[model samples]
Target chain A: MEVIITKDLEKIYNPDTVPVHAVNGISTSFEAGEFTAIVGPSGCGKTTFLNLIGGLEAPTQGDISILGDSISTKKKSEMTDFRLHNIGFVFQAYNLIPVMSAYENVAFIMELLNRPQAEIKDRVMELLDAMGVGDKAHQRPHQLSGGQQQRVAVARALASKPKFILADEPTANLDSHATETLLDLMLKMNEKEGTTIIFSTHDIRVMNKARRLVKMDDGKIVENGKPDTA
Target chain B: MIAKLAWRNVWRNKVRSLVVIIATTLGISGALFIAALISGMMDKWVQNQIETELSDIQIHQEDFVIEEDQKFFFEKEDLERQLTAFANEIKEKAYRIKAEGLAMSAHNTYQVILLGVDPDQEPKVTNISNYIREGAYFKEPGRIKQILISQKLADELKVRMNSKVVINLSDIEGEIVGEAFKVVGIFKTSSGIFDESHVFVKNDEFAKVLKMKPGQYHELAIRTGEEVEVEAFQTELQQGLDADLMAESWIQMSPALKMTEGYMDTFNWILLSVVLTALIFGIINTMLMVVLERTREIGMLRSLGLNDRKVGLMFILETIYLSITGAIVGNILSFFLINYFGNKGIHFESWEEGFEAYGLQAVIYPILELNFYVLVTLLVFFTGLLASYFPVRKAIRLDISTAIRN
Candidate 1:
């Protein structure tokens, strides 16, 4: 099932003084359980497109429908609620709360969802173990290596059981070894849990790991298909 | 969960948070201590006056209160019997003959209020006996009438203890009577003015010279039980008195003290406003910095589904934690500081003369009520809430996409 569909999505910066079309008329959709990567050079509007889909920012024009509900029609506060209930995010820097332990970071999303403590505990441990970070559950983000922190971040994203996860450059800061580990953990989550994930990356290795790839340049998709075919 | 996050967030920057907490502690405690000092000073002044000069309650012939003439006198026997009925509330009662008179010595003459008292009964009602700086309170035994003059009057008249002074005053029949009295005691009180304007003599000798009977006394002073409500007791005593007489509590007799007591609350709030105002700014500055420093973290939380209200609540909780922690420590510190200084006393010996002129002692005992501490803590809590406004707004207004990039 298609979880996200963008219809001619657009975002313009400094529209009045000097309009810059960051995401110009993008059209796309992602199926559930697809480990998809949107690949492009720097400033190619990959993050903006993800943000539009995640309801983190409003598009100057066009509609982003997540599970058949158009997010462009929602108010700012309503959009925040929508984001909390339906979307989970993983940033390039692995933005896990520094003050929280890995377990706590994973549990935080479910807590925000108001899930029961017992259920949150079971789910958090399950996800942490799946990500191969169960033993590091009690360690804060600062105490973990880059790969471990990214794994924790993935667990946090999956904790909410959202329709899809939006990851922005999930491995840009990691070494090749850490990047390989994080990608494997994410691929495991995608296969085992059927979690639809759409991430933005410039790394060829990351694009290679994606089951599907959408290649972009100058804020428009140049290609979209299987990674090898694309 | 929000509270936990906020609390842990406060300690994220230990040095910055500690600076705010310590500043709040000093501000709140300093305000409370200053308030206690002033309160103690005022309370002690009124108490001292009531104990040493004006007994807790006083009764006089209505005409005598209106006009300070020797002719206006009360029937002592009947009034004494009436006062005894309140024995449970009235600890001690004394009757006195008060006259506007002049004390003449070889060197000088001074106008004074000549108070004729039964020394034994007078000492029971008032603490003047304890203030005797030289000799004893009417202790000399002689056919020559003995008197007590304040050290202030003694200095003015160039007389010492046992010096001879002449008492000249009006009798009840409006006749001028002159009599010789030897100063047996020289007393001093906290009030320099009270000391200079009053002289005491034996009631029998005073009455003999004035050609009056013991029953015709001008004033009746009663020291009531501390636990008794003074105003209510005064009203009850007044209702029980004869139509020709009137009773007054110390507050009624001294309106200035009453006014000062009323102003104390206003004074406390003013001091708290000054302290809390400073505290509010300190919190705002610190919290603004917190928001600025945690932009990316806050952005991450926001992007992770933390709603605007929850984000605002988290910052509010953080501000409250900082302020309340300081308030709790500040109040505890104030409690100990007030009690310590209250017992030890804070002396201003250099200003002794100025303080004494207004019936105040040089040393002041700091004091505060339990309700005041509770009030200050609540003010600090509200102050925390108020101080959180700008920071909460700043946090909630962050651009999630832009902040994440930071």
Candidate 2:
């Protein structure tokens, strides 16, 4: 079943003065448990499209539905609550709160959701262990390597058990080795837990690992296709 | 966890946080110390006025207070009967024959209030004998037909121990009379005006010169050991006395002293407000910097679903922590300093003339009422919250996407 649908989605920057169309007339849908990559060049609007779908920014004109609930019409505060409960995000910078330890960063979202302490701790430990950063849980983000911090970030994203995770250039700051390890861990989470993951990136390695690719250029999708295993 | 986060945030920039904390500490302690100093000075002024001058209560003929004519004197038999009625409450009492006169020496002449007192009874009621800087009080064996003059008066008249001065005044019969008396004692008191304008003489000698009937005096000064009961005792005395006489407490006798005591709290609050205003700005600047520096982090938290209220609460908690910590330290240090100085006193010997002009001693014992400390603590707490308000509003108004981008 399609968990997210976008219809005629559009975003324009500096709308009145110098209208820059970032995302224009895009209609798309993603199914549950699908690992999809939205790939493009640097200014092709991949990040803006991701932001529009994640409800981080409102569309200039269009509608986005997550789990069949239209989110574009919601108030800013209502949208925040909806996003908290439904969509998990991973940023390129792995923005873990510097003051909190790795475990606290992951558990913080669960705490926001008011999850029981026992369940939050158990799930947090399980996610950290699965991401191969369980031993680093007590350390702050600065103490962990880049790859380890990214793993902790992914663990934080999954802590709330949202319907899907939206990652924007999740490997943009990582080295080749760290990028490979982070991608492997994200893929494992996808396959093992039947979790849906949609990532926007210009990186070929991310596109190569995806089960499906949607290519965009100049704010419009040019191609959507399943990658051939052969 | 939120509180924990806020607490940790306070110490994140050790230097910045310490600056605010120190400013707050200094502001609180400084205001409190100044308040204590004012209170101490006021206390000394009131004490001196009572001990060396007013005593607790005084009685005057109804007309005498309005008109200082010597003829307004009350019969001593009636005064003695009223004193006997309140004998249980009276600690010490004295009758005085008072006259407005001019005292002249070889070098200078000054207007003075001449007081004629029974030397032995006067010492029981006031500290005049103790304040004598040279010579001796009226009762000394060789000091017959003598006067006790203030050092200020002696200085102005250029007279010394055993110098003779002439007191010119009207007698009870409305005739102007001049009497020459040897200056047997020179007294110095904290009140410059009192020292310059008053001289004491033997009441018997004064009566003999004025040709006054026996058992008649112009004023009665009473001292009561139970200070809190002074006003009540005054009221009782007024009711029991003859209709022509009036009894007045020290507060009634000196309106300026009453006003000063009443305005002390208002003065203290104004002082605290001025200090707290400066402190509030310092705190706001510090907290605003903290918010600006953590813009990205705050945006991340908001993106993670922490509501505006929680973000505001976090900032407020941080401010309160800083304020409370500073207040605690400040109060502790102030208490220590106040106690030390309250005992040893802060002496302004160099400013003796200036202090004496206001009837205050040079040595001030710093004092703070217990309630004043509690009020200061409460004020600091509320000040913290007030100072945080603007910064918290700014933090909550941030656009998450823009903040995260920054």
Candidate 3:
């Protein structure tokens, strides 16, 4: 099943002054069980594309239908509503709330969604156990290692039972061992749970793990194909 | 949840929050003080207006007050008969007989307020009994028909208590009938106008000297329970009395005195408004700084799926929390100062120069009363809320994306 699609996707960084086209004329679809990666250099619209697909930002000139709802025509408040219900994002900096411990950071999204206390506790414990940081649930972000913090971010992103996860450089702060561990977790979730994954990254390990790779150069897509070096 | 979050948020920047709290506390303190002061002044003016000036009723010639052009001299026997009947039914009365008399003393001769009273009934309806200083109240009522002269009048007369003086009563033929009087008492009424001019004599003595019929009367000193009840009593008395007699309550007797009180009340309100407005601005400044400092944190909360209203609720809750905290602290501190100074006032040495220079006998002990705490609290609570209102709006209206970037 098609979990996400964009028609004539275009995003402008600033539409008013010297409009900088950040995403231009892209058409795409992601399947339910795919692990996709969008790769590019700086200012090449990778973040812009991820923001659009996650419903965090609107397209300057295009359409996005996520599991069949027209996202672009949704009101701003409604677009945010869609994000809250169906999408979860991980930023480059891990973005684990400083005030919350690892367990609380992971449970934050579920709390925002007003999940039942029993369900939230169960889900948060399950996510933390899966992320291999169950023993460190009480540790704050600065107190934890970079890998542990990023794992908490991943746990938070997946806590709300979203249809897909949008992670921006989730492995950027980790070493090789930590990066491989986080990647393996994401790969296992995608394969076993059929949770679609869309990430923007420059990491080769992240790129190699992807089922599909969408590469962009200067706001326009240069490649959209299977990541077999073809 | 919002309240919990906002409370936690306040501690995020302790120094900044403390700054806001202190500034707001100062504002509350200032506002409370001024509101209390104004309300106290109002009570003082209202007290003086009613308790000191006019009595319950003033009995005069049927048409005397209206027709001052004709001296329709009071008939003592007939007026006394009516007064006795009035006294029988309503005991809150002092028959005050008044006449315009020119007095010549050692240093100064001026027109004076000569009041004649039943020495027995003087203490019944008014505070005149307490105003007597050097001599005792007329014990025999009719036997010791001596004058209780005012301190200022005594000073002008160059006479001490129990000194002999002569008062002249004029007849229809313009001949002066002088009578010797022993100054048996001195009245030092605190109010300046009364202290300088008023003199009291036994009613019978005044009648004997003027040879007014044994029962003539001019005015009535009447008492009621409270100042607010004066007008009610006056209106009731007016309805019962004959149209020939003219009656006025204190409010009408000295329109200027009442006006003085009314103007003071207005001034008090104006001063409180100015002080509280300044206080509001002070609160807004502190709260705005607090809101501006929390922009990034607020953005993070918004991104966590907290809606605009939840964010607004957090800020407003914090503001109310801040206001309530500050008001309590400030009220405690200010209430101490109010009590300390309310009872033992700060003397105005500066104003003494102006008062004495103008021959204005200074009021050395100006009483500062703080009986209206509820009024002060309510005024401060509302002002505190108003002070926080706009800052709350600004906090709520933050653009999350822009805020996050900053």
Best model number under DockQ: 1
What's the lDDT for all of these models?
Answer: 0.91, 0.89, 0.70
The residue pairs in collision within model 2 are B76-B215
Local accuracy of candidate 2 as per-residue lDDT tens digits, B139-212: 55454579999999999999998888998888988898998889889999999989999999888888876777
In candidate 1 chain B, what residue range of length 10 has the lowest lDDT sum?
Answer: B76-85
RMSD (Å) of each candidate, 1 decimal: 1.6, 2.8, 4.5
lDDT, candidate 1, B1-406, per-residue tens: 8999999999999998899899889988999999999899888988888888788999988988998777888787788777777879988888888898889999999999988898889998888899999999987468799999999899999999878999888888898888999989999999998999999988888888888786778888889887999999999988888888899999988988889877986888898999999999999999999999899999999998898999999999999999999998999999999999999999999999999898889999999999989989999999999999999999999999998988
The share of true interface contacts that also appear in candidate 2 amounts to 0.44
Give the Cα error of residue B130 in candidate 3, in Å: 3.3
What's model 1's lDDT at B128? 87
In Å, residue B9's CA in model 3 sits off its true spot by 2.2
Q: What TM-score does structure 1 among the candidates reach?
A: 0.97
lDDT of 3 by residue, B1-406 (tens): 4566567666667776677567656765665566555545444444443444465556566655665322445655544555453343454666756665665555666576667787777677666677678787655554445877777778888888877766765632345777667787886654556666667778777866666665566666666554446667667666666566655776667677567657765675676577667767766777788778667666555655666666667667666666566667777877886666566654555675454333232333233345444555567668867776787788657765555445
lDDT, model 1, position A141:
88
Taken in order, the candidates have interface RMSDs of 0.8, 1.2, 2.4
lDDT of 2 by residue, A84-167 (tens): 898888988899998899999999989988899999999999999999999998999999988899999999998988889999
Tell me the TM-score of each prediction against the true structure.
0.97, 0.92, 0.82
Better of 2 and 3 by DockQ: 2
